[model samples]
Target: MSEEEHQHPTSHYVKIWAILLVLLAVSVTGPMLEIQWVTLLTAFGIAGVKAYMVAVKFMHIDQTPRFVTYLVTTTLVFMLLFFAGTAPDVMKDHGTNWEKPAWIAAEAAYAAGEVSHEPEHH
Candidate 1:
């Protein structure tokens, strides 16, 4: 084996272990935090950081070429944008604008053969 291959240090693994420990501690005691939004944000942020660390160090993707990294980054970016853009439509104030159309009931009646047409004579 060449010296260059052997030069791949083990400190990355140690860093990964340390990050995993912190993530585990947070997961175990996360419910005890009372800061609400701040707590949630911090937890998510830490989780993202830990995931990135694991992907780069343990998965050895950090050694991958730049194009592959850009492809992964672009995919994540587009996914986040799609989620952000569509979430509001799902959680909006759709009061009277949400009512069903009268044509729907008419269609049901028509399908059931319940329609009636009468002519008045004077």
Candidate 2:
């Protein structure tokens, strides 16, 4: 097959770029509407669309073997799983055996309109 057979016209790329720019504009403006669901929709949903476009069009991942896509997807799942497994521990302020007194104090102070002290880590 010739290179021309695999090549798209410059106009095609320009059109794709224009659409991506429009999506970018929408995503950027989404947060300013001050709606939580709408903000998340544009931030994550439109970003996902932009990522798919870049991967399929620019990277030509569509032409790759199916397993490459599977690998990427599996990796993403594992990353999410790791975050899920660790996030609770990371976010907790206290437990039965241990506590975060400094952080808790600092947060309470800040909330009550007092000067906040930095938490000490050991």
User: Which candidate comes out best when scored by TM-score?
Assistant: 2
For model 2 the TM-score comes to 0.70
TM-score of 1: 0.60
For candidate 1, give the lDDT.
0.71
- Residue pairs with clashing backbones, model 1: none
Provide the clashing-pair count of each candidate structure: 0, 0
lDDT of each: 0.71, 0.85
User: Over the stretch 1-122, how does candidate 2's per-residue lDDT look in tens digits?
Assistant: 56676777889888989999999999999988979999999999999999989888877666567888888779879999999998887778887688899878877878996764434421
lDDT at 96 for candidate 2?
A: 67
- Per-residue lDDT of model 1, residues 51-74, tens digit only: 788777777677777788888789
